[model samples]
Target chain A: MHPLAAVRGVPRRTWLRWRFAYLVLLPTLILFTYLRVFPTAWAFVMSFFEWGLVKPAERFVGFDNYTTLLSDKNFTTALLNTTIFAFATTIFSVILAIALAAVLARVVRGRTGGLLELLYFAPVLVPMVPVTLGWREIFNYNHGVLNAFLGIFGITRVPWLSDPNMALVAVIILSVWKQVGYNMIILIVGMRAIPRVYEEAAAVDGASAWQRFRHVTMPLLAPVTLFVIVITTIASYNVFTQVYVLASDVQGAPGRLVPVIVYDLFQNGFRFFKMGYASAEAVYLFLIILVLTLIQFRFLRGSRA
Target chain B: MNLRRRGMSRVGYWILVAVLALGGIAMIFPIFWLFSVSFRPASEINTVPPNLLPVHWTLNNFTVVFQRAPMLSYLWNSFVFATISTIFIVLTSSTAGYIFAKFKFPGNNAIFMLVLATAIVPFEIYMVPLFLQMNALHLVNNPIGLFLPFLVLSYGIFFMRQNTMTSVPDEILDAARIDGMSETGVMIRMVPRLLAPAVSALAILAFIQAWTAFIWPLLILNDPKYFPMELGLSQFANTGSSNFGVTSAAAVIALLPSIIAFLLLRRRIVEGITITGLQG
Candidate 1:
């Protein structure tokens, strides 16, 4: 340490401190760089080549994979279907969550409210595989509880998983049911974080409950609401498990009927071994999310001011 | 005017309560249905008019599920994977978080930002190359492969760093250092004790994630012996006789650990989500 201190005008104390810090951080940094950072960079590189599992060598095809994606019917269908699913789920889930959180905020001091919160959050805790398995039965055409309940009103059995549009709707319904409570809880926390004095002051100034909420509560909630929207949208765009289990078949057929981005990527990469094309699709997904995140940052900065 | 307004507001409040109760019922009905179907006799499961509750409850489905698959093995695998991975995550996250929060070193913010950047990128994007890398390393089809991708979570580091900043005091650490305690010793003994609540919360989150992870496991493991509960259940549902009752039983088995965990540690789980905005 004394020799090091003499070498470059560095003190031994600072050197020792730096050494300890680095030693502590070494394991995490090494794992992240190897497992996460390297692979991400490799994926972007792999996207420019025609890589396959059984091929002897990777053939360089610059921009070819991306161009193929633009023309691929399956890719286009998946992109469109995923877009619809993402927008619908985000809008419905965010609105319902806010409404539920608002009502719960009114009654959250009671035991009933606590129980309700627990019940709602239970789905979010359970794994997606089981949730989708349970829903498959509920969405069954003949023996399902949903159709049976509908039959009470003399409505016919709906082919929930058979028809393409209804199948997508079914996926959307399952997602919203699973996701609403999470957003509601987050929004509730955000609402509780708001200082009460401002609301009390507004009340003293003769503001009605509705007026106070619309003016004071709503503006303060903007940031959290935006956060919920962005997070929900991103999560919805990555929807695969529910669709994989509920809508598609064993070989992932009818993925066409209910085409989604991740399903397409899974089929391409894992099933067909078309690694390069799949990497291109993944890059597209990454770009989409990147844009969304950047937009979130922009809005977040604006809201702060 | 005040009395009339109060009466109207009371009516509105009751209406909202009723709506919330109905929504609560909707939320929990699927779980109730899963249990009911799993316990129902096969003959009663597909009856012309589906009974809301089973007219005759039976354990036949559970027996059939166990007979058809090695469910006990699947549960054991899931438990081990979740437990071990959680330990790694907590150890790495706490040490790294402590360093970032307390130590003022060169490239600290830059390194922390690099870690934070990885948190937002979905795993699906890089999984192809990751799969190849695992194959090259001869880790594919091995249990070690399952733990490789999850060894270091960017989210865990970020969460712990934020918690450490707010919770841990610097004076105590300085005192410990001045008392001739090594940095590693201070970290191993004192830091974890001070951050026990955050550590527990992080542990729960990590445990739940490792327990429920599907996609990566599906890609790495083709051997049934290594199949976690979720993968085992999905395979059974798809390849088995398509018996809804048996499948429901299998699904119930898969969901039990998490449900039990949530029931016991609900407050910590809720507090974790509230603080971290991390959905389990």
Candidate 2:
């Protein structure tokens, strides 16, 4: 209902109090829709048409773009690769984050604890480009830090990002390293919020340390855990700048992770000038995220019930 | 968790702390490596059985970076973009967040939810069309094009709204209104003062986001001088491996300002990031 709905049956001058909210909200709404909403809607509209940057014309192609996308090797690769990336990064990062938070929350307290927490949170500040580039150097096939360290143990140099089998793992590790701290901070706060009474109750019942955490702490931390999963999954699936720097020859070295979605989109839209085709890919990506997010909301609502 | 109350030994406690501390160091090792490699000579950078510390520390890489490109100018481009964008986003997000959190206006929930939904949609979804949109506006080669899309961030608005819900009480606004302050005046004078923490947190986050921005800037701008340092760092990698030392140095320089900003405002960044994570 309108803020003026109650006043609609009355006079306008009598209830003009809340109209300032609309006035203040206009700039943000206008700019946001203009920049974000308009472009997104335009992408959807262009997906069904043969929009080309080269020929400078558009034709209604219906589901042709979609069909073409479904058959594209790069598209299929991206679909599988992105799924693996999302789930792997989310799960691995979440597990490490939980363990770190639980331990730090228990063992460390005081100024030292605070300092350590800050140190843990430090990577969250580093950008994707630097982190990815740095890791690219570290993951180098020869003379890289990791390979050199492994060599110290009498192991041969192992190609990190270059090997097809290890490429996804390398990517996952790169992301997880940057992400764990943010999740740790969140989980720590979540753990801190869980009342000590629950733990005490579990303790009095003769639950061991592991048992108490498994039964009491884990159950109570479900909401935050679910949140972490959804966030990390969404972020991981969209990892582009890192992949661009790591895999593509955009930097000096060619990347081995061939089927990542955003990189595919970049190649299509920018490199190949297939704006319409790329738009279709974008639509699929958007729908996947939308469905995932909706599923999360549904699960949370169900848990509440 | 009061796990200590259950008769865990002091030795075990220190052992756990030491292990966790080691893990912490390991987690940030890449950053430490980046810093260490910044000073390493070209020979030591790719040496087998890599020296943990630089064998021959040199400022030569820094000199190469400066001589090769207008690196500081690139940093200036990034700094200006980050600063200006942060200011605009902070002002815009706070104003909108104040309304969404405090006012019961028409379309409040609907509009707020629309902004919230954008958080889930990655920029790639609309990035092609956005490129065309910028092209239409003749901003493809313009710096404004790089910063425009981020001027009002969804996460900033959402974070500010969450902070406002808890921080700014309605009674104070009412009191301000009663004292003859207009609605806008009340917001400008009182609400912002109260939202200082949220504003600072949002500002730091916005600064970093804009500073580290890559894809859009890479697409939007053409000239090397207009390039942000994030994009500039790519040249080192793209051009060749011979400049590996300077490449690492450039990467360090690119990340330095944001790291400094984050260090100065780690408390706020942590709070801001947590609110985002919690709400998600």
Candidate 3:
């Protein structure tokens, strides 16, 4: 017998039939353990220790790292900012997309909207570093296009990224711009899934277009919107690249209102070399995400009910 | 009813056309501005009345970007990472999908759910420990480090499994088996062609993901030479002057492959999203 056969037990006749399937599945299991299971479990253990990768020692500090996270001002700012950004991005994108889908769905029914799709999906196609940084340049204090446009109106420049109050808003707008198209496409697909027969029945009942949409379309579109909300909220929490590119210069002015949890963890672990502290943040982030997801499920179903 | 309906619908459709047209412009305007900004000379970029169209359109910034930075090297690195990883992803995911679709094995459902559950937690959850793990393995700061995270996309497998379950009928597999083919032989010969659409969609998704990936490469590879296009552009974003045109130019150049891929494989991309929507 092959040395590997020890893992699967003695090959009964029945086991021989399923051997190829297990053989094919070996790579998937190996990758799953390597990439996901091991790392995740390791992160949980590391969260408990005072394990700074920079330092030579890995002290077992117990709950100290987790407790310190409660009072870390930067950590506090990041958590608050992350929550706000996640909520705003998810809600804003979901609403705008459905609204766009509502209009574009009608348009597609009347005519093929291929051109419209290409145009809307441009952002999703375009890489983030460019679009977000490109917006950063446009939002520049002096020579930016937005300021230049405002120069036409004789309005003074607004420090879009530099000003702490405006920085999160700036990041939010750029994110909304990037992801709205993706949500719009998904929702448009959702809109198409709603049978035309229902609309025709509503029309026969002499319901106005607005009434038909309110009474007929909205309820049916709920499931897709919920999916969009969950995905977008998760995406919003993980907003790092755009922040790194756009708001890197914005120091803690209004405080770290735009520097989110991922950004915070990155700085702590990577830049500051505080691995254990960052791992604790990671643990918190995991809990927050798990709790929020559960809450969103309840909220979505509850709202519908 | 016909005349009234015609008038109302015509008005509604035109309103929609205008709305979508304007929204489309908003969507693509930043990229247009990036291209426009990139072509402008340093002085012209700061002109009093900012022209949406570049008055002095030159290849100065792009040329500067290529000359000043190791751009071609970055592109080459990105190309290698994306291509190799994409092939790995498609083959494994499709095979996994095929097995999950066709086979009845112990622990299969448990395994699939574990794969799917990982999709919710972003890489940030485990990235710190992953970094240490890579360091322990001496895989950090290497080219292999850059490609490590994408070794298996959980979502790709999930996407493939869904496609296979619906599309890859068992009749074809049994037909191949009945013809005196071995199991591996049947999988190798027959399954991939049938799963071509899922394969193509995933290829596009995975390639673009690897090509445009920044954080993993940034976190893993400390060496400048191994930096991919997005990380390369980020270097420009930070250390470069406020001239901004050059950085925008670099951004545009870096984005070219993904844009081209999107344009070429537009249908598969849409189909991928449609499947996602239908399942949702």
On TM-score, the leading prediction is: 1
Chain B TM (all candidates): 0.93, 0.90, 0.90
Please, what is the TM-score per model?
0.96, 0.94, 0.92
- For every model in order, the fraction of real contacts preserved is 0.73, 0.74, 0.67
Give the per-residue lDDT of model 1 (tens digit) for B1-280: 2312422476776776787888899998888888888988878988867887889889999999888998889889999999888999999998899899988888999999988888888999999999998998899989999888887888889888987898889888889989999988888888888899888888887888888888888899999999988888888887848588899999898888888878898888888867667321
| Candidate 2 pairs with clashing backbones | A78-A259, A247-A255
lDDT score for candidate 1 against the true structure:
0.86
What is candidate 2's lDDT per residue for A1-305, written digit by digit as tens?
45546646644533455577878888898999988889888898989988888554379899999999999988998889889988988998999999988877765777868877888888887877877778878888877889888887999888676665577778888888888998999999999998888888888888888888888999888978888888788877787777777765323343435458888888889889989999999999998888879878987897698
* C-alpha root-mean-square deviation, candidate 3: 3.3
| Candidate 3 residue-wise lDDT, B1-280, digit = tens | 3323632677776776787788888788888888889888888877765778888788988888878788778889989999999988888888887887778878889998988778667798999989987888899999887687787888878888888888878898889889988888888898888888778777877887888787888899877798988888787667746467788788788777777877897878777655644452
Poorly placed runs, candidate 2 (over 4 Å): A1-10, A54-57, A249-257, B5-7
Stretches of candidate 1 above 4 Å error?
A250-257, B1-8, B278-280
Candidate 1: true interface contacts recovered: 0.73
RMSD of each: 2.3, 2.8, 3.3
DockQ of every candidate structure: 0.62, 0.66, 0.59
Prediction-by-prediction clash tally? 0, 2, 0
TM-score of 1: 0.96
Best by lDDT: 1
